[model samples]
Target chain A: MELGQKIENGMEGRTGIRNEMQMSFDAISENEAFARLAVSAFVMPLNPTVEEISDIKTAVSEAVTNAIIHGYDEEYRQENDRETKKVQLHCRIEKDMLYIQVKDTGKGIEDIAKAMEPLFTTRPELERSGMGFAFMEAFMDRLEVVSEPGCGTVVLMEKRLRMAEEADEL
Target chain B: MENNYSENFKVIDNYLMVRMPEEVDHHKSGYISRTADDYIMKEGVGNVVFDFEDTRFMDSSGIGIIIGRYKKISYFGGKVFAINTDTRIKRTLMICGLHKVIEIME
Candidate 1:
């Protein structure tokens, strides 16, 4: 099945969301960086200002870095046995709202709730502040995490750019 | 990619001075934080002054690192100060409420 088909199958039954786009790439830090920029560009034509753009970029970077550094661990693993793992990102923009899903078929998070806690990290050796989810939550309107042991992990985030009152409050 | 670090000690006391480069971002923040941590331990610096004469960009992560350092040195009765600033970093400092704690040099 195509990558999009796989993601759709994985995300099925959760919500009847549409206008989704899926992008997949081999597990590389550079790829993760590029994915962030691509997602930003994809959302830019919607007319977000430079500050909004920076917030989105920072959130996307945290998400992508988490995928590469925690989800995959391919970079630190032995390169000789490197199996090309992939990080798939699915984005949907509808009705002035943006929903993003980033999934990785590598090591699933041990405790989803704990991982979301601010300043809590399982990979301190890698200098991860465990603040990825916190930043995502701070930047976006909603954040959801779904994972299964030995299966994979998916992070879903939603944000609305048109909420002027909400923006002022934030 | 461009940064300068100097380890200078006072002639009569045990204080270390770190002039953090003007531009601090995700890439250089960690390095500067680590260097400051190590320098404090090695030089037994009582007070740390971070001369932000040329700093342009700093986010929450940078603030976190600074806060971590402040807590680390507080046991020794040492304090941290930020010297100089631009509008951008100043706004970040204000948002993070560091101005209430750290002394900002004029």
Candidate 2:
């Protein structure tokens, strides 16, 4: 699965990382589907159920879409003609828990609190539901957003996998 | 997008039936929205029925696609229906509180 020509990849571990992978790709809408699909494949070793796989994929989709749509200001990018925008996805698997980090170096969020509000979209003309963060929170066990104006945004999400036998509990 | 996705739109009994793609996301939302809205405007489609049988993965962008169409048609008393929704899709609808606006059918 390819998403926006992977620019860089690396592996780093701090807390006894079982497996970790990181890749950076162009921040274009074309990557949203492939990005999530790649993460879904990365977590397959956990033996996630259909529901769990869906959950992880949806969360990744939301994060990557946010990075492309909101992080890189469409108007500014269009004016500058510098479409080399990039999004970084880093995933680590330790035990049954999956940790995901999606980062972008585009214009950061001005008000993180208001941006996370359900149904509050900055680009209403585009028909955005403003449910990106909300959906990420619902699907993942933990979600954290850190951003600064003009610097960029980073979304951190973690999900604990349940084997097939335990999938029914969810 | 290159394969004339508008073919997926069909008007039956005044209801616009949309055969969603395999993966609905931001990349495809523009096409879905443009094609569906055209039917709603030109063919005068009343209600909208979104068939998710082909959709293996969908994010919140799918919600936007549904709601954008709902907003355009609901003013004329048109309703939106989601059919063939699975467990994950149902959970997403429930999470976003979309049941209040759109009807989910088995």
Candidate 3:
């Protein structure tokens, strides 16, 4: 099965997919904004509310930032190894739900549970607020992080959009 | 006295007002914090006002910049203020507990 097919099959209750797009870019700080803009544009067809768009943008920003800052170490980049230092973003819309996955092939987290703590940080000297995961969790309806030491980390986020008729009830 | 450091930074009265750029992520936050800190120390300004009228997005890095500034100014009986924040940015600030330390002005 194709990647899209795999994602669709893995997710239950997906009535129908409206669109799907996948992109890969170098793990650089400048690409953070680019990732956000790309995701925003891809999801535009859904006519998401301003608040919903903001939530998606913020979540993407956090995930990309993590891939750039914590994932790829400076020493690794200094070695001029570019191929393995890539960030992949996959987004798809099924029915009223938007699914996004950000994956990095850099240093992975050892303890997922500890890292998810609101104020936990590995690089405190860098002045990191340590709220990256917290913000991602707050902005999206569902979040999942999978990582293995010395391998990579993947962040999956999903948001359910309320149809116009459904929104009116609220 | 008035000193304009750049197009985005200016000192008015006793408040050092900074007009943030469109996006304030980790890449830009460090530079902003350093420049603002220099101004506060050299100019001895007691109040720092952030003008976010044009900012569209800010992440945890932006929060760190604001909190770092709050710590700097508060050390010398100074205060940090934010003006013209939109709903999204305001919510980010509130969630990070910045409203408790920095004053958000209308």
Best by TM-score: 2
TM-scores of the candidates are 0.66, 0.89, 0.87
Q: Residue A11: error of model 2 in Å? A: 22
Expressed as tens digits, the lDDT of each residue in A95-137 for candidate 1 is 4577888887767878899888877877654455456787788
lDDT (Cα atoms) of all candidates against the true structure: 0.66, 0.86, 0.85
Q: Mind giving the per-residue lDDT tens digits that candidate 2 earns over A48-114? A: 8888899899999999999988888776477445545889999999867899999998888999999
- Itemize residue pairs with steric clashes in candidate 1: B22-B54
Q: Order the candidates by lDDT, highest first — what do you get? A: 2, 3, 1
Estimate the overall C-alpha local distance difference test score of candidate 2: 0.86
Per-residue alpha-carbon lDDT of model 3 for A1-170, expressed as tens digits?
A: 69988765744323444789999999988899999999999876665788888999999999999989888878657754788899999999877789999999888899999998987888876678888999999999999999997788999999987652264344
Which model is ahead, 1 or 3, in terms of lDDT? 3
Q: B25 in model 3: Cα distance from truth in Å?
A: 1.6
lDDT of 3 at A106: 85
DockQ leaderboard ranking: 2, 3, 1
Candidate 3 chain A, run of 10 with poorest lDDT: A8-17
Error of 1 at B52 (Å): 7.0
Candidate 3 TM-score, true structure as reference = 0.87
Model 1 regions lying over 4 Å from their true place: A1-21, A25-33, A74-80, A125-127, A163-170, B1-30, B42-44, B47-64, B81-106
Q: What's the ranking of the predictions by TM-score, best on top?
A: 2, 3, 1
C-alpha DockQ of every model: 0.13, 0.87, 0.70
**Runs off by more than 4 Å, candidate 2:** A1-17, A79-84, A164-170
Candidate scoring better on DockQ of 2 and 3: 2
